[model samples]
Target chain A: DMKVTQMPRYLIKRMGENVLLECGQDMSHETMYWYRQDPGLGLQLIYISYDVDSNSEGDIPKGYRVSRKKREHFSLILDSAKTNQTSVYFCASSSHGESSYEQYFGPGTRLTVL
Target chain B: QQQVRQSPQSLTVWEGETAILNCSYENSAFDYFPWYQQFPGEGPALLISILSVSDKKEDGRFTIFFNKREKKLSLHIADSQPGDSATYFCAASEGMGYKLTFGTGTSLLVDP
Candidate 1:
């Protein structure tokens, strides 16, 4: 079965605290992405990693960073948590040489910053 | 910059009715368009997609009608069910799906 998993489905942190969001996929997809969804802004891409240690910034990468040390795992980190940063985070993966660039998404993580 | 845009921010339709969701993009470079569905407290899932080469693509009851010249597309969900009630997002990418930009989304409600 193809699946993507995320740790800490729910998280709470205080202001100025560091936050980590981890994602793992079973399909060994070559590309992984991090995104955050807001009420009116929609799904905003934070980062995209093509492979291990190869990453690119998305539309909203100002307060976030991503790391991909393995083909199956990707992580999103925030140096300082702010109330404005609180939102649901999603991790997605896609493979090249496929019929199309269809992205498979993980459940997601809800983060709250106080 | 909100390159992609969705209209009718919210829509309500009776079960078995057809629900139409519209989307438009600002960039001519975007050749791929995909529609994603998101339920409450869940992640968005790829519902259907279309390439610039195709004007229409269908999967079961979901269909995408694209007009490349106008840079517009619409998703038509036939016989929508209550289970189909969710937020629908329209996304675009310049090359494949490596990087995507999504629209605000349209909240759909199917009344059974």
Candidate 2:
């Protein structure tokens, strides 16, 4: 089955600490994305990776960065976690050519910064 | 500014009734629209979608009514069930683009 997987479904970190969220997709999609969901704010895009080493910032990319070293894996890193950064993070992947609009999302990671 | 907007932040409907979710966008360049369903504690999943070229698109019991002139669209869920109790998001993307701008969402509750 085609699936997207994320590690550490739940995480807690002290303010100013570092964080790493990993995502993997078995579909070998060329486009991968990172999004954060906050109450009443909907899903805000953080970054979009078109392919290996080709990444673009989304609407909200501050305090966060992404890495795509392979076709099936993407990573989101928080250099200095802040309390306001606490939210559910989602990782999604989509095909390159036809219907790239349909993004298959993973289970998501609930991160809390204290 | 919020490019996409959804109404009825919350909605309630009987199991056999139809639920209507409204959405609007400010970007005229957005030609593709998709609705996503999210269960509690899970990421959102694609439920249905419509292109600006079409006025209506249907799949199963879900239908999307689009009006390119008005820059508005809506999702009608026929025979809503308790299983349909979840959050629905309206998202839009520019011409054949990958970045999607999403609305806040509507929390739907289907009572049985």
Candidate 3:
């Protein structure tokens, strides 16, 4: 079975601190995505990596940056964490080719900024 | 415009009852629709999906109803159990290699 692993199930950071959320997938999927889930706001895409070193901004990319140094790993960085940035973050991977495909997601990381 | 829209932000039902979750899309180019289910503290998982060419698809108790003309679809959970309590999200995509637009999600609570 394909599995996506995320580091630090829970995190608490101070305002202006740098935060890094790590994700690794065993499926070797070509597409990876980062999303934030907020109450009543739903899941908003933050970034997407099509391949190694290839990153694309999503609708909500402000205050966030992403890196995919390797095909199996993707990282989300918060250069300066703020209170408004606290939310549950999810990492998803898909093996979609020419046809649309389903994405497998990680357990998620809940981050709190104070 | 919100590409995907879901109704009944929250719903509660007794065990064995059928729960219907509705979803609609504005983009006519959307050819693939997928329903995702998420439990508390976990990420959403692909529960079921259907294509534009198909009107309905079923997997056990979960069924998808599609209306091409209306550009709407629905998820019907038959014989819902307490374990079914979770949030369901509906997503749509136009074609391959594209990002999916997701609905706000509907919370379903199945009481025993």
Best by DockQ: 2
Each candidate's lDDT (Cα)? Answer: 0.93, 0.95, 0.94
Per-residue alpha-carbon lDDT of model 2 for A1-114, expressed as tens digits?
Answer: 989999999999999999999999999889999999999989999999999999999999999999999999999999999999999999999995765568999999999999
Model 3 chain B lowest lDDT segment of ten: B92-101
The weakest ten consecutive residues by lDDT in model 2 chain A span A93-102
How do all the candidates rank in terms of DockQ, highest first? Answer: 2, 1, 3
Q: Per-residue lDDT of B1-112 in model 3, one digit per residue for the tens?
A: 6779998999999999999999999999998999999999999999999989999999999999999999999999999999999999999888644588899999999999
Better candidate number, 1 or 3, judged by TM-score:
1
Kindly state the fnat score of candidate 3.
Answer: 0.72
What TM-score would every model get versus the actual structure?
A: 0.97, 0.98, 0.96
- Residues A14-68 of candidate 3 have per-residue lDDT tens digits of 9999999999999989999999999987788999999999899998999999999
Candidate 1 per-residue lDDT, tens place, A1-114, comes to 999899889999998999999999999799999999878999898999999999999888998998999999999999998999999999999997758688889999999999
Chain A TM-score, candidate 1? 0.97
Off by over 4 Å in 3: A97-100
* C-alpha lDDT (0 to 100) for residue B24 of candidate 2: 95
